[model samples]
Target: MSCEKVLALLNDWLDDELDASQRGQVRGHLDNCVSCAQSERSLRNVKLLVQAKADRGEPSDGLRNRVVDRLTHERAQGPTSLRWTRSPWLRAAAVLLVLASGFVIYSVVISGKLPSIAHATVAEESLARHIGTGVEGPVEPRWPFETIEDAQRVLERELGTATKLPIRSEQLKFKGASPTTYGSARGVRLFCEYKGRPFSIFALESIPDEVRQRSQCCFCRRKDDRYLVACWAARDLYFSMVGTDLTEGEFMAQLMAR
Candidate 1:
């Protein structure tokens, strides 16, 4: 199978969802193709990491109990009988319950006002976008050091110590590409390799009001490549990064460290 086909099937293959014949074919191709071999290895590592995390534990029992109780209450109050639904009190109670459920979902999913599984999922997705889209294209050598301490020293010299944000490389697992410009208005954008992966980082003094209003950004990649991007505002600085050649989880881990 072609590389593209293999890539599309990669997630399923990793999950062991592929049929026996397909799995054998993919394994055979991987044995002969260096690029496919590397991709498979990376995906396997990511699966292992995710499985390890899941094995640690689920959400607290208290949270699970609350969710179960709410569902049970909803079922009990649900249309008891055809005539019961016509009663005004029952109708009002049903409306109130719907509103309450909506509020709970919004709090957990949208506003992130609650500590729940949904909140954690959203945060992880945000981090993945930030780290994955920040960098694109060929991997670049890290600022010339094997250790975080050395990276910190180099970053201090280049960016200075005026900001509170700490610069540490212990978390940087990959680096990619020499810095490049995204567009004139956005200024110089460079692709950095961290934790053995690529991310795009931008140094913008001030984000345009229009960009902030829309909360939308654009990213480009080679025709067949996939990328994830995330952006944030830090004081007067605005930064966005894209990830390529890395799993979403791996990219998020690197970004959260920042």
Candidate 2:
């Protein structure tokens, strides 16, 4: 398929709304066309960005309060007295102010100021830390437990819930666990290594519906061909694993077995 045709079908292809033959054709094109492949990756990233924004829900309380205060002041002054209502430049400035507020909230989310499973920020932070590309900050690595029971003790202490670790081959060595908080919910992130490649497993008490609806049991996707993120919902908790060695299908099988 030509690049133009591929562009036309990109949305459906990503949404899995295409028929089998159409999907095959698009896949075939993506495999052979470097430009189209890059376009698809860009589109995928856009989708993830939008999902992150939606999963973040609303703006911060401080932002909302500022907006509310502005509105209240405007109400007291009345619309006729409000400069923004009469001056185009002032109206434009008001719009810019709102945009600036949104940018500030986004900056906080990306900076790891808010750690929550409902938002993508925490996941990105965890993955970055695992890969050693995390921003300069205090290292909170906790692990090398002598027994699974020991890890469970820490998990319970941090998350207020006890979760069983999935059985895995000895080739994968357990490193440690880290306490993670997302809003009012709490969870634990477990780190491991497979042949020197780092991997992470985390369990969150509340899973966003957008994530849960995407997969009945488990879902997996690759990020820039560098790593894999596999997630599943089990026993009132949401579980996710990140690494490159394990495929989504393989991860799902193990999760199902558990």
Candidate 3:
């Protein structure tokens, strides 16, 4: 895909509306293009800021009180000081700063980074690993592993619970499994092939509750049209599934259906 096409699809990509194949094209393009990469970074930063602002939900009483108190104090100051601080332009600037500070605090407290970026970072990593593996190679899982059972044992040793493999259908073929690290957390990834398409499922213990709570069912994002990321929290584990052929809703239904 050209830079223009990638740029045009960025917003849909961020919102998880794009299909998996398109996502892969964007990811592939961004890999070798420095200019597009920079544009992507800038666009992502703006998205993170916007998501942080919305995730804040509502103003906190303490933050509101502080802003109000500052305004009231400035109002009560003598005329000389008022002349310095009471200009309309200065008040607008002050309000903007306060709001900006509130978002900064929200980012720090909620996820220690912008929640969207942090989650997207992990998703991007998953997509990279999956894409790099390609579609037709012999499934070789790392860490001396061969089976999902082995992966479960290793994951249990690290995370204290066996991975809950979500596929129940007889047609889903297990390809391989491996352990992985996302941010500061350790987890396991299971690879499978269904209907000739390969995908990966990841389980991590590091996602913040704030980030997990953003979606009740699944939080999906697109790295490229062919790459889809679907994430959710369960018990003490945060789970993500990345696939080139899967839709967020389909992945969720497969994993979550009883």
Among these predictions, the greatest TM-score belongs to 3
lDDT of 3 by residue, 1-258 (tens): 998998898787777887889888888988988998888888889998887777656777699878865565444332632432423212322332333334445646886764232322233444345434433324344422345676544433322222233222344456666666555555556776654567666644345434443432232345544455544443334555566576543433343332
What overall lDDT goes with each candidate model?
0.46, 0.50, 0.51
Error of 3 at 180 (Å): 0.7
Worst 10 residues of 2 by lDDT: 159-168
Candidate 1 Cα RMSD after full superposition onto the native fold (Å): 28.0
The superposed Cα distance between candidate 3 and the true structure at residue 13, in angstroms, equals 56
Question: On a 0 to 100 scale, what is the lDDT of residue 175 in model 3?
Answer: 68
Model 2 TM-score on a 0 to 1 scale = 0.31
- Model 2 per-residue lDDT tens digits across residues 81-103: 24223322122223322333344
Best-to-worst lDDT order: 3, 2, 1
TM-score of each: 0.28, 0.31, 0.33
Query: Each model's number of backbone clashes?
Result: 30, 2, 15
In candidate 3 the C-alpha lDDT for residue 137 amounts to: 29
